[model samples]
Target: MDEDLMRALREDRGVKATALAKALGLSRVGIYEAVKRGEIQATRIGRRIVIPAHVARRLLGIEMEAA
Candidate 1:
């Protein structure tokens, strides 16, 4: 995983499941499974599902910024 890419995603509010899957080099189904397993947090906005940046950081074991 690219730290810079992850950081950029973290700086954003969230990312789409498909985009995140691409970023993590996993299939869309794999990302969905992670969401199902509670390894990542997701929110439904209209028809789109988004995963928050902080949650991704935590899952990837990246250091979080002070709140």
Candidate 2:
């Protein structure tokens, strides 16, 4: 996976699952499963689900950005 794409996904608060899947060369179902299994963190936002950038970096074993 491209580190830039990973970083982008990990820094963009509003990055969607579909976009992440495309960027990571992963299926959307795979991303969903990861969320379901708590391998990644996500929260419901109205009718949409969102994953935090910090959580994404953590899941990738990368250092989180400074808040």
TM-scores for the candidates: 0.63, 0.61
Q: What are the Cα lDDT values of the candidates? A: 0.74, 0.69
Q: Put down candidate 1 lDDT per residue, 1-67, tens digits, no spaces.
A: 6555566665766767887787668898999888888877898789787888766666556675664
lDDT of 2 by residue, 1-67 (tens): 6565565655676556666676667898998898889876888788665777666656555674565
Cα-based lDDT at residue 25, candidate 2:
77
In candidate 1, stretches whose alpha carbon ends up further than 4 angstroms from where it belongs are: 1-10, 60-67
Estimate candidate 2's alpha-carbon lDDT, on a 0 to 1 scale. 0.69
Clashes of each: 0, 0
Return the top candidate by lDDT.
1
Task: Tell me the TM-score of model 1.
Answer: 0.63
